[model samples]
Target: MSRPVMGACDACKRRKVKCDNANPCANCSISQISCEHRIAPRKRGRPPKGSLRQLSQEETCESIENATADMIDDSPVNSLFEQDAASDPQATSVLEALATPFSPGTLTTPPSVSTVLRETLGKGSLAAFAAVSRNQFVPNVAHIFQKLAAAVNHQLADEGETIATCAHKCVDIFMQYLFPNTPIAHEPTLRSAAALFDLVGDFLSPEDDETPSIERLRALTLITALCALVNSAMSQGLFSTSKSLTWLFYNASRATLRLYEEYDLEFPHSTSYHIRMWQSAALQNSTGRDRASWHIHGESILLAVRARLYDEDTISRLPQLEAQLLRVNFWLMYLADKTAAAFEARPSMIPNDYLAEKLTLREQGGQDSLQLDLSRPCNGHSLERRLLTGFHLKRRLWAAAADMICELRLFPTRNQVFLANTEVDRPDISGLVERYLNFVGHVDHLPEWLQSPQRALEGVEAHVAEYQAASFWAQRSNIMSVYHCMKLVILQKCIEMAVPEVVGLNQDPIFWAMQKLETSRDFIREVQMVPFVCFKVQGEPAVSVQPFSLTSSVAYSC
Candidate 1:
């Protein structure tokens, strides 16, 4: 008789071992990880897993695995349990983290190096640290970078369109549609091949092996992600298929870990670092990897705080453009991180106290990177000014939402508090409600182009006026997405907190969720209608995924 094929966790697949298919399968359980079943095992007698094909046609079966090609990772899942892997010691630190695939927002912070070291040494003494080195354990990406860089370089060559040309087109699509609030790679340096790599810095690892520059990797990742967005959009489907773009993203994300080491160094120089992180995280989040996105954004936060981007004194000292970029950057990270937490139904990484001084400072100094304000009687303020104003309005609105997430985080865990348990301590969402209410009221104050029933894709021409007009609509569309997304998140939390014993049964939170469900349906519908010749994506900027129907999704789940 043919032996039965079994569904194995990635770990066992790498080890070429068997898995029992338990939630925390025997191997993962032995490894002490939350087992995540990704690919289904081949039917008992059916052929083993076959090569994945380009998903040109929609299949009846709906799953990430079928919708997209299998992503390639650097190491086998079984590498962690290898005797040599244990000997290397560094892998032990990140083993638990990398092994865990779920991202529901309840994840603990990546264990500190010290914490990992302690675990690594066990009963051994501190000398063990002296003996352990990253060179021995760190995954070598020298050849990988060489291959990636060559692929990118080849693409950048002037075949059909130079990598620069094609990348710019993708960048514009990313800017106009994917993230209107956050401009993607507008640096003039990107235009020049010579200056581009210069800005990316030397990416050689300690082992003297070449690696893709942080900026280079980030740019390529964004371009691929943008292409993915455009391929999904109304540009009449400019790109043929999303297969290549999606494949590129899968490969690029593998290099993300090395960038974290740069948090100890290179990340702060380019404003694009965190932006890229947010964008990549969004792309990953859409792929059902909210936890991965959250982790990536957390790295951005670490870099931002270490660079003192949050300190008003440091920000005030920055150059005009850098200062403005930092202002917007901090808030975008804040909003992105907050959304990730709320989506997975977990406590926020950002604390409320961080905003106490920062919010007022942004409202006063930052003009959302537009560097202009025409809020007064139309002193002939340009459309760009209006767009910037909308950006500012979004910053202000999301700032409130950030506060809302932080305040809501104070609630007891979902399992800790029951609907009928009034005796337990729960968080106060009153502030969240008021802030969100205030945010909702201000949402209408934005220009007409930014509000509903407005055309976002009209006026397709090369002229300045035509571009601005279209740009206005796109920016407004992005702002609306962010606003509605925030509303959905806040209301979802309120609904979750509504206990028969605490807020009482049939309460306003539940009522608001019902009401917001309509908003979500409408917003998601409108979002789908926005036409892009290249790519389209949802959530990401705020929460980093297509959170268009977060409220409605939550409502249904309940």
Candidate 2:
């Protein structure tokens, strides 16, 4: 037979796919391989050169291995491999060699180890040893602690690292130091010795997971420090300094919260102190105005505690946790108001991006400038961010309160009802349904607006009146329900206060008008009436007959 065209396997020419060729192609040998069938090569102004050809599998393997080895052996290539493998688990030996104590550029290097440990511990090491104090390793322990403390102290002195950063490192060392059975002094001893609590409080980053016990312990210590600070500051008889102490208290609380967040923790019992104060302030005030403000502040701390105590599933067990967390919920309901108060107290602290717009005509140099450089400084930006945080935090608190009340409305817990109306509701909330019906069904959002005796509702009387009128209609009976509840609550509260007739049932003209209106029909179950329980004018029952804005009436008439 004539020689048949033969060619190498297609895989030989392409870098992909393994070739099954021997000398040329095994099949080609069986069928007689031919070079004529090979793919054409490039031509240099001449006819095409020889076509593709195949080689033995051994030769091909050798060639490929040589090419790979060459690439891998290059200086740059080898260095990359070394760098990558150094971090790999398989490279333990290599990493071990590199993991020595921190040098000048290393993260683990202690800045002040020699200063603190060598000097401080040397003073006490002999005492620790003579008594067989766990100080057997006192020298070593002190060395490590001193070095770390020195490094940390040095880092803190730089002002480059924040209190937060120092707190993190300090906690890490403390945890490691305590994890072993080594005999260190009590936590308080360490705290006092290091002045750590004063420096960092209890910084708990949500991201860490070293020791739950340590985190909780540190949190308690920080709380103790805070109480001490508050107590001491109060005793100083310096309001300004006391205010700063409160700020410190807030910072300490914030730091504790961070730790609680990290270790899935809660200080429910410790938090009860604030809760009681809040409830006392809230329930004690018949006007429910100042109580509401206090309640808001109380709620914020309560929320922080609650977040540590329970997770998402806590709601499923809301009833059981409610009484305990009600104090928290109570305070949460008023956080927005508290936040707003804080904001108002430091208006200058509130960052305003549009502040430059307030510049007077003369304040703007070379008037008629198209655009002024309104950009703020670094500090200004920081203030802006802080203000934004406060604004957002308040907004979140308001939203949370609304949602909580909505949830409370559905659950109908006794504590919630008592919170709604202190007068009719039992001190213990046993009359939940009755108090709830009297307060929630009738009060609506009026309780929230009861800031300064319904100042907010009064200013927007036209709006209030519109809603109040609609509430009287059968189709929109829900509104009327809430209004009735509120009226009853206000009356009960007034009676409890033992105000004379001029200030109680007989004192409020609106109450008398409503009484008259209710008596119009002997058997009337429903009546269309005004929702204002606290009237604007006194000794003028006719004033209730006229539609008056709560604000204008309260200020002008009263």
Candidate 3:
């Protein structure tokens, strides 16, 4: 048989199958096609001694100059590898030495002791420490790069739409469903950030440079967190497969946030604070009352306090738009803090004393101490203004409810300690009853427009009525659920506090139990009024069911 040829035939190479290296290979012969070897075979084995001649001094110098020119070129691919190589001196030096040319007669220098040690020990050295100093000093730097790589890989592997498209959709979903209720982020700012993010081809692209700026990092953090939240919300009903994507975005947001914190530790800007606040909201929605959610909520509160977001005087000194955004942001935080504290049965991170002082100052100023100012008024009874007004009213209600929860928390301790004491020695049952009555009265006194969705849209423009109606219905449902839940908690606590000996003497446990049943019925009615789509799309049932469960447990215990 003839000796086999050096390389595969064209047909076998094109099909990527093994070749017999015959003139007409078995594959092509079987298929009745002509076989060609037009492509050159790769050179194999080392060249014989003296087969290659070293370049002259001038030739070596010219080659070295050409290599240096290529290295210094501002090309994108070159710069990317350069940036990565720059992180390690050993790698950079090796690359440089490989690129340099030498004359034939030039004497080669012996390797240094440090170089020998490095080669022997294989990367265990103080130099490695110095090389990774950037990662060591900056929090989450390594993790951020890892996430960037993963995001890039995911983008590359995705056969469908791009991240930019998904990001735009997430933003739209967030603005439509969540913005009116939460509105922690400024609308224009969020849109602008999304627009800018769309322009980024790759997060670690050479065009973006070696290091990202604080502003870029902040925008990335916000976008990722927003996507995570929207994905989490959508995963509830629209897309069953989105849970993994939701967590992917969530973890990316966390990594970006840690990197941003490392760079901007001293002054936590509104954007960073907004990222944290929204992250906490996402955590609450995705994970429920987890410790991570609680910790993130606390971090946001700390950022707000540090930024003096709670101080009206400080807020008033800013531009009108900024002041308005900050005002809404702070109030949103306030509402969330109270809700988390009440539902989680934990002490609120926000200082009640500061809130009390603010109320006192407002009373002294002759304003309605119970009502929080919703900042600058819009020109007309616009939908945004109405929604803001309603949200502030809801915030007031939650504040009251949280106060009751705190008082109820103290009751168990007091009841246990003063078991044999009179009712006077225990937490004043009358005070608790009074607060419950007041909370109920507050809900009853809400404006007709806020209480009813149809009333909210009575005079709205034709173009905006749909949005206004949706906002009103969502807000009303939220307020009513909170109201009914708070009522159940207070009444249940009242029943618990009513000692068997005092039940007949002071208040009737049967009456409180009956009231709880009534409130539960009202809650059910309100829940039924909401569209079934709302329960599925917004995960409303998951949120509302927890309170019902709590009420059930309390009733069984009683």
Candidate 4:
């Protein structure tokens, strides 16, 4: 008969010695390594036992034989347990769990100086500064910088887009958080990079020797974010007007350009920046014509953009143009509004009789102007009631330009693409054209207290084609998907009205409310995640909470 088998510790199994069945045998326990044990769940029922006295030798032998037979039957269970332990919860360790797996197409390595860098540059790396030797940690800083620099160089040498993107992101984050505010005791890059390494130190410990995919995605996202920010500043003039803010904008721009150069990426179009700089400069002082120059530049940009939209190779130009045009309309409206206000505040500031007559008309009836439906794209009426001052006309033209942009965006396709091809069929923009007519029909009826009639009328007229177009933009998903972009645009436009003295003092109620609209727009962005893109000048946020039901999506067409 076979003797009954029993479990043993790893050390006992290796030595072929009988184990006392401690969690770990004495040898392994003393070595201070992991202690593993195989334990089966307790059975439900009691085992059979002798009822009275001790058994005789012959009975004991028979019992032993039965026990040996039972052990043989359970041997397969032990083998199963061994298989499960290889990856089982009981077998897997905390250290192993902490190590995140490296992404594919990357190399992970054991923690070295890079580990120190991650800790140092990471978010909260200075916790144990008193315990660890400062000198030891300091040396690791240089080593980390060397590694990062080498990594960047290697990425540059390689043609992989992913690697290049990742390298740029690492560099950008380092620049944003580290170099900007931190006081540097050494060369900027060294301290900055070291600071960065400190943040990610936890991951470096017992490093799994694999390259991370998270880093790649992180880099791509950061680059995209930076681009979006720069675009916002350019389109909205957020950082352009103030001297302090301009530095922020300029640094962001420089950082982006450096990233682009690092990967041999082509520069973005040159026109957008020039226009933004021009708008910024105009804001330095109160000059309407100078502000209008921004509008002219915008028109030039729009025309240039038309020429470049067709070649499949020129896809980048589309967004650049769209953003610039959006900005142009915003600033043009800004200048017109300001010009009208100037005429109101100092009637003597009227440059000519044309402006003077319009200002008179605006002063008499413009303060009570009602908003036409901006949700459905349409143009407003012509300014028949105007007189001398250019203020009303300027304000109207600005509003009209804004409406035109909305129509331009909603047009089935760009006119420039059609111009590029001699044989290309020109589809009618009649839909938007019709909406513009509806907008005009209502212009004569809308109150002038809130806006200049001419401006209101022109804006309504620009939406004519939107009424006839398909309702693609009216969907919940589509509206929300681009809501962030819309909010961004609105905030940018409102910011354009930053003339310190003139805009506030304008007697025209519409111009007066423009200040309120500035604050209102910002507040609306903060609260209303679901934006209706209203064209009506003064609706409360509560009015916008309902589902947007305009047939034409060009409601804010201007």
Best by lDDT: 3
Off by over 4 Å in 1: 1-73, 76-146, 149-165, 193-238, 249-267, 275-279, 282-286, 340-344, 354-384, 401-436, 448-462, 482-558
Worst 10 residues of 1 by lDDT: 57-66
The residue-by-residue lDDT of candidate 3 on 459-479, one tens digit each, is 666555655556566667666
Q: What lDDT score is found at residue 349 in candidate 3?
A: 71
Give the candidate order by descending TM-score.
3, 1, 2, 4
Clashes of each: 16, 21, 0, 74
- By TM-score, is 2 or 3 better? 3
Error of 2 at 350 (Å): 26
lDDT of 3 at 558: 7
Off by over 4 Å in 2: 1-214, 217-229, 232-558
TM-score of 4: 0.19
CA deviation > 4 Å runs, candidate 3? 1-161, 200-210, 338-344, 351-381, 411-428, 458-463, 499-513, 535-542, 548-558
Candidate 2 on 194-237: residue-level lDDT in tens? 34434442332221212234434344434433332222223223
How many clashing pairs does model 1 include? 16
The Cα local distance difference test for each model comes to 0.45, 0.30, 0.55, 0.30
Scored by Cα lDDT, where does model 4 land? Answer: 0.30
Q: If candidate 2 were superposed on the true structure by all CA atoms, what would the RMSD be?
A: 31.8
In Å, residue 217's CA in model 3 sits off its true spot by 1.7
> All candidates' TM-scores?
0.53, 0.21, 0.64, 0.19
